[model samples]
Target: MGVTIRPQVGALPVRFDEDGILQVLLITSRRSRKWIIPKGNPMKRLAPHHAAAREAFEEAGAIGEIEGRSRGHYRHRKRKARRQFRCRVAVYVMTVERRVERFPERGERAVRWFTVDDARGAIRNRRLRELIARVAADLASSGRPAAGQPA
Candidate 1:
Protein backbone atom coordinates (compact mmCIF):
# COMPACT_ATOMS: atom_id res chain seq x y z
CA MET A 1 0.00 0.00 0.00
CA GLY A 2 1.12 3.53 -0.69
CA VAL A 3 2.01 5.65 2.33
CA THR A 4 -0.68 8.06 3.28
CA ILE A 5 0.32 11.73 3.20
CA ARG A 6 -1.51 14.00 5.59
CA PRO A 7 -2.77 17.42 4.59
CA GLN A 8 -1.78 20.42 6.70
CA VAL A 9 -2.22 24.17 6.48
CA GLY A 10 0.22 26.93 7.39
CA ALA A 11 0.45 30.69 7.59
CA LEU A 12 3.39 32.91 6.90
CA PRO A 13 2.69 35.88 9.12
CA VAL A 14 4.16 39.14 7.84
CA ARG A 15 4.11 42.75 8.98
CA PHE A 16 5.65 46.06 8.03
CA ASP A 17 7.71 48.28 10.24
CA GLU A 18 7.51 52.10 10.43
CA ASP A 19 10.14 52.19 7.72
CA GLY A 20 7.94 50.09 5.44
CA ILE A 21 10.34 47.19 5.66
CA LEU A 22 8.71 43.77 5.67
CA GLN A 23 9.25 41.22 8.38
CA VAL A 24 8.06 37.67 8.75
CA LEU A 25 7.13 35.92 11.98
CA LEU A 26 8.59 32.61 12.99
CA ILE A 27 7.61 30.29 15.80
CA THR A 28 9.56 27.56 17.52
CA SER A 29 8.21 24.07 17.14
CA ARG A 30 6.95 22.39 20.31
CA ARG A 31 9.05 19.28 19.80
CA SER A 32 12.21 20.43 18.04
CA ARG A 33 12.16 24.04 19.19
CA LYS A 34 13.35 25.01 15.74
CA TRP A 35 12.13 28.05 13.85
CA ILE A 36 9.06 27.32 11.73
CA ILE A 37 5.89 28.91 10.44
CA PRO A 38 2.65 28.37 12.36
CA LYS A 39 0.90 25.25 11.03
CA GLY A 40 -1.46 22.47 11.97
CA ASN A 41 -3.80 19.78 10.68
CA PRO A 42 -6.92 20.76 8.72
CA MET A 43 -9.78 21.73 11.01
CA LYS A 44 -13.37 20.62 10.59
CA ARG A 45 -15.89 23.14 9.23
CA LEU A 46 -13.16 25.63 8.37
CA ALA A 47 -11.60 26.42 5.02
CA PRO A 48 -7.91 25.69 4.64
CA HIS A 49 -6.91 29.34 4.84
CA HIS A 50 -9.07 29.91 7.89
CA ALA A 51 -7.49 26.93 9.58
CA ALA A 52 -4.09 28.38 8.73
CA ALA A 53 -5.10 31.62 10.42
CA ARG A 54 -6.12 29.73 13.54
CA GLU A 55 -2.78 27.98 13.65
CA ALA A 56 -0.96 31.31 13.40
CA PHE A 57 -2.95 32.75 16.27
CA GLU A 58 -2.53 29.78 18.55
CA GLU A 59 1.12 29.13 17.80
CA ALA A 60 2.43 32.69 17.39
CA GLY A 61 -0.09 35.06 18.90
CA ALA A 62 -0.49 36.60 15.46
CA ILE A 63 -3.74 38.13 14.30
CA GLY A 64 -3.94 39.06 10.67
CA GLU A 65 -5.82 39.09 7.40
CA ILE A 66 -4.80 35.96 5.57
CA GLU A 67 -4.91 35.54 1.83
CA GLY A 68 -7.22 32.79 0.73
CA ARG A 69 -4.96 31.77 -2.09
CA SER A 70 -2.05 29.61 -1.11
CA ARG A 71 1.44 30.92 -1.72
CA GLY A 72 2.84 27.44 -2.28
CA HIS A 73 3.10 23.90 -1.04
CA TYR A 74 5.73 21.99 0.84
CA ARG A 75 6.19 18.51 2.22
CA HIS A 76 7.66 17.52 5.54
CA ARG A 77 7.54 14.73 8.04
CA LYS A 78 5.46 15.21 11.18
CA ARG A 79 6.72 13.38 14.20
CA LYS A 80 4.41 12.12 16.89
CA ALA A 81 5.94 10.00 19.61
CA ARG A 82 7.84 7.24 17.80
CA ARG A 83 5.86 7.58 14.56
CA GLN A 84 6.47 9.84 11.61
CA PHE A 85 4.03 10.67 8.87
CA ARG A 86 4.62 12.56 5.65
CA CYS A 87 2.63 15.76 5.49
CA ARG A 88 1.88 18.09 2.61
CA VAL A 89 1.40 21.70 3.71
CA ALA A 90 -0.36 24.46 1.83
CA VAL A 91 0.88 27.83 3.03
CA TYR A 92 -1.00 31.09 2.99
CA VAL A 93 0.30 34.62 3.45
CA MET A 94 -1.08 36.60 6.35
CA THR A 95 -0.56 40.33 6.62
CA VAL A 96 -0.55 40.89 10.36
CA GLU A 97 -2.62 43.69 11.83
CA ARG A 98 -1.46 43.14 15.40
CA ARG A 99 -0.32 40.55 17.86
CA VAL A 100 -1.79 39.79 21.25
CA GLU A 101 0.09 39.30 24.49
CA ARG A 102 -1.72 36.06 25.23
CA PHE A 103 -2.93 33.20 23.05
CA PRO A 104 -3.72 29.50 23.24
CA GLU A 105 -0.16 28.24 22.89
CA ARG A 106 1.66 31.40 23.97
CA GLY A 107 3.92 29.86 26.54
CA GLU A 108 4.33 26.59 24.72
CA ARG A 109 6.20 28.19 21.82
CA ALA A 110 8.57 31.05 21.27
CA VAL A 111 7.69 33.62 18.60
CA ARG A 112 9.91 36.13 16.86
CA TRP A 113 10.06 38.31 13.74
CA PHE A 114 12.74 38.25 11.09
CA THR A 115 13.56 40.09 7.93
CA VAL A 116 12.99 38.25 4.65
CA ASP A 117 16.66 37.30 4.32
CA ASP A 118 16.97 36.34 7.95
CA ALA A 119 13.80 34.28 7.85
CA ARG A 120 15.17 32.16 5.02
CA GLY A 121 18.30 31.41 7.01
CA ALA A 122 16.34 30.52 10.13
CA ILE A 123 13.97 28.11 8.38
CA ARG A 124 15.42 24.66 7.71
CA ASN A 125 13.02 23.47 4.99
CA ARG A 126 14.28 24.28 1.52
CA ARG A 127 10.84 24.53 -0.07
CA LEU A 128 9.62 26.76 2.75
CA ARG A 129 12.58 29.06 2.34
CA GLU A 130 11.95 29.29 -1.40
CA LEU A 131 8.30 30.12 -0.76
CA ILE A 132 9.27 32.87 1.64
CA ALA A 133 11.67 34.34 -0.89
CA ARG A 134 9.05 34.31 -3.63
CA VAL A 135 6.42 35.92 -1.42
CA ALA A 136 8.81 38.52 -0.08
CA ALA A 137 9.91 39.50 -3.53
CA ASP A 138 6.36 39.84 -4.70
CA LEU A 139 5.27 41.92 -1.71
CA ALA A 140 8.31 44.13 -1.79
CA SER A 141 7.92 44.93 -5.45
CA SER A 142 4.15 45.15 -5.47
CA GLY A 143 4.36 48.84 -4.34
CA ARG A 144 1.17 48.52 -2.36
CA PRO A 145 0.32 47.17 1.03
CA ALA A 146 -1.63 43.95 1.26
CA ALA A 147 -4.79 43.81 3.39
CA GLY A 148 -3.34 44.36 6.86
CA GLN A 149 -0.04 45.99 5.99
CA PRO A 150 0.69 49.59 6.82
CA ALA A 151 0.02 51.93 3.91
Candidate 2:
Protein backbone atom coordinates (compact mmCIF):
# COMPACT_ATOMS: atom_id res chain seq x y z
CA MET A 1 0.00 0.00 0.00
CA GLY A 2 1.16 3.50 -0.78
CA VAL A 3 1.71 5.58 2.30
CA THR A 4 1.01 9.28 2.65
CA ILE A 5 2.68 11.62 5.09
CA ARG A 6 1.96 15.13 6.29
CA PRO A 7 4.76 17.34 7.54
CA GLN A 8 4.41 19.09 10.87
CA VAL A 9 5.13 22.72 11.75
CA GLY A 10 4.59 25.41 14.39
CA ALA A 11 2.64 28.69 14.82
CA LEU A 12 1.52 31.03 17.59
CA PRO A 13 -0.33 34.36 17.29
CA VAL A 14 -1.86 35.87 20.41
CA ARG A 15 -4.53 38.49 21.04
CA PHE A 16 -4.26 40.80 24.03
CA ASP A 17 -6.66 43.45 25.27
CA GLU A 18 -5.86 46.62 27.15
CA ASP A 19 -7.17 45.09 30.34
CA GLY A 20 -4.73 42.22 30.00
CA ILE A 21 -7.33 39.73 28.83
CA LEU A 22 -5.33 37.47 26.59
CA GLN A 23 -7.00 36.37 23.44
CA VAL A 24 -6.11 34.55 20.23
CA LEU A 25 -6.81 35.11 16.56
CA LEU A 26 -8.74 32.50 14.64
CA ILE A 27 -9.78 32.31 11.00
CA THR A 28 -12.84 30.63 9.59
CA SER A 29 -12.33 28.36 6.67
CA ARG A 30 -14.76 29.07 3.87
CA ARG A 31 -15.20 25.46 2.84
CA SER A 32 -14.48 23.54 6.00
CA ARG A 33 -16.18 25.98 8.37
CA LYS A 34 -13.50 25.19 10.89
CA TRP A 35 -12.03 27.83 13.17
CA ILE A 36 -8.28 27.54 13.20
CA ILE A 37 -5.20 29.58 13.94
CA PRO A 38 -2.82 30.83 11.29
CA LYS A 39 -0.18 28.29 10.30
CA GLY A 40 1.60 27.04 7.22
CA ASN A 41 4.52 25.07 5.87
CA PRO A 42 7.93 25.77 7.30
CA MET A 43 10.08 28.26 5.47
CA LYS A 44 13.38 27.34 3.94
CA ARG A 45 15.94 27.27 6.75
CA LEU A 46 13.76 29.50 8.91
CA ALA A 47 13.08 28.82 12.56
CA PRO A 48 9.60 27.89 13.73
CA HIS A 49 9.04 31.23 15.45
CA HIS A 50 9.90 33.11 12.31
CA ALA A 51 7.65 30.87 10.29
CA ALA A 52 4.86 31.40 12.76
CA ALA A 53 5.21 35.15 12.50
CA ARG A 54 5.08 34.95 8.75
CA GLU A 55 2.06 32.71 8.79
CA ALA A 56 0.27 35.10 11.12
CA PHE A 57 0.73 37.92 8.69
CA GLU A 58 -0.24 35.86 5.69
CA GLU A 59 -3.21 34.17 7.26
CA ALA A 60 -4.53 36.75 9.67
CA GLY A 61 -3.16 40.04 8.36
CA ALA A 62 -1.40 40.39 11.69
CA ILE A 63 1.87 41.99 12.72
CA GLY A 64 3.25 40.80 16.01
CA GLU A 65 6.30 40.03 18.07
CA ILE A 66 6.91 36.64 19.57
CA GLU A 67 7.17 36.59 23.33
CA GLY A 68 9.08 34.40 25.76
CA ARG A 69 10.22 30.95 24.73
CA SER A 70 8.33 28.48 22.64
CA ARG A 71 5.21 27.44 24.49
CA GLY A 72 5.27 23.76 23.49
CA HIS A 73 4.19 21.29 20.83
CA TYR A 74 0.99 19.60 19.68
CA ARG A 75 -0.08 16.97 17.20
CA HIS A 76 -2.85 17.14 14.57
CA ARG A 77 -4.34 15.14 11.78
CA LYS A 78 -4.64 16.25 8.17
CA ARG A 79 -7.33 14.67 6.09
CA LYS A 80 -6.89 14.22 2.37
CA ALA A 81 -9.16 12.85 -0.30
CA ARG A 82 -9.18 9.34 1.08
CA ARG A 83 -6.70 9.20 3.91
CA GLN A 84 -5.49 11.04 6.99
CA PHE A 85 -2.00 12.05 8.02
CA ARG A 86 -0.58 13.08 11.34
CA CYS A 87 1.38 16.24 12.00
CA ARG A 88 3.11 17.77 14.99
CA VAL A 89 3.00 21.53 15.53
CA ALA A 90 5.15 23.58 17.89
CA VAL A 91 3.43 26.43 19.66
CA TYR A 92 4.86 29.80 20.64
CA VAL A 93 3.58 32.98 22.30
CA MET A 94 3.31 36.24 20.38
CA THR A 95 2.22 39.80 21.08
CA VAL A 96 0.16 41.56 18.48
CA GLU A 97 1.89 44.68 17.22
CA ARG A 98 -0.62 45.67 14.55
CA ARG A 99 -3.54 44.38 12.55
CA VAL A 100 -4.86 45.45 9.17
CA GLU A 101 -8.50 44.94 8.44
CA ARG A 102 -7.84 44.41 4.80
CA PHE A 103 -5.03 42.00 3.99
CA PRO A 104 -3.59 41.96 0.51
CA GLU A 105 -3.73 38.22 -0.11
CA ARG A 106 -5.96 36.44 2.36
CA GLY A 107 -9.46 36.79 0.98
CA GLU A 108 -10.70 33.33 1.75
CA ARG A 109 -10.69 33.75 5.53
CA ALA A 110 -12.69 35.74 8.04
CA VAL A 111 -10.55 36.84 10.98
CA ARG A 112 -11.84 37.35 14.46
CA TRP A 113 -10.53 37.66 18.02
CA PHE A 114 -11.57 35.38 20.81
CA THR A 115 -11.06 35.48 24.52
CA VAL A 116 -8.97 32.66 25.96
CA ASP A 117 -11.98 30.62 26.90
CA ASP A 118 -13.82 31.27 23.68
CA ALA A 119 -10.75 30.56 21.61
CA ARG A 120 -10.26 27.29 23.40
CA GLY A 121 -13.79 26.26 22.54
CA ALA A 122 -13.65 27.51 18.97
CA ILE A 123 -10.73 25.38 17.90
CA ARG A 124 -11.50 21.76 17.12
CA ASN A 125 -8.01 20.54 17.84
CA ARG A 126 -7.51 19.56 21.45
CA ARG A 127 -3.74 20.09 21.51
CA LEU A 128 -3.98 23.56 20.01
CA ARG A 129 -6.61 24.50 22.53
CA GLU A 130 -4.31 23.43 25.32
CA LEU A 131 -1.54 25.59 23.92
CA ILE A 132 -3.86 28.58 23.80
CA ALA A 133 -4.85 28.01 27.39
CA ARG A 134 -1.23 27.88 28.50
CA VAL A 135 -0.36 31.04 26.65
CA ALA A 136 -3.37 32.84 28.04
CA ALA A 137 -2.36 31.89 31.55
CA ASP A 138 1.15 33.14 30.94
CA LEU A 139 -0.13 36.47 29.64
CA ALA A 140 -2.56 36.84 32.52
CA SER A 141 0.29 36.38 34.96
CA SER A 142 2.61 38.73 33.08
CA GLY A 143 0.81 41.86 34.38
CA ARG A 144 0.81 43.66 31.07
CA PRO A 145 -2.01 45.69 29.60
CA ALA A 146 -4.02 43.95 26.98
CA ALA A 147 -3.31 44.91 23.41
CA GLY A 148 -4.89 48.18 22.17
CA GLN A 149 -5.77 49.24 25.67
CA PRO A 150 -4.84 52.57 27.18
CA ALA A 151 -2.53 52.05 30.11
Q: Per-residue lDDT tens digits of candidate 2, residues 31-149? A: 68699877667788877777877777877888877643467777767766887787666665667778987775478888888887988888898888887787677667876523333
Tell me how far candidate 1 lies from the true structure as C-alpha RMSD in angstroms: 2.4
What C-alpha lDDT does candidate 2 achieve relative to the native structure?
A: 0.71
Give the Å error, residue 116, model 2: 0.4
Q: Which candidate leads in TM-score?
A: 1
- For candidate 1, lDDT tens digit of each residue in 30-102? 9889899999999999999999999999998899799888889999999888999999999999989899998
- Stretches of model 2 off by over 4 angstroms after superposition: 1-7, 145-151
Best-performing candidate as measured by lDDT: 1
Worst 10 residues of 2 by lDDT: 142-151
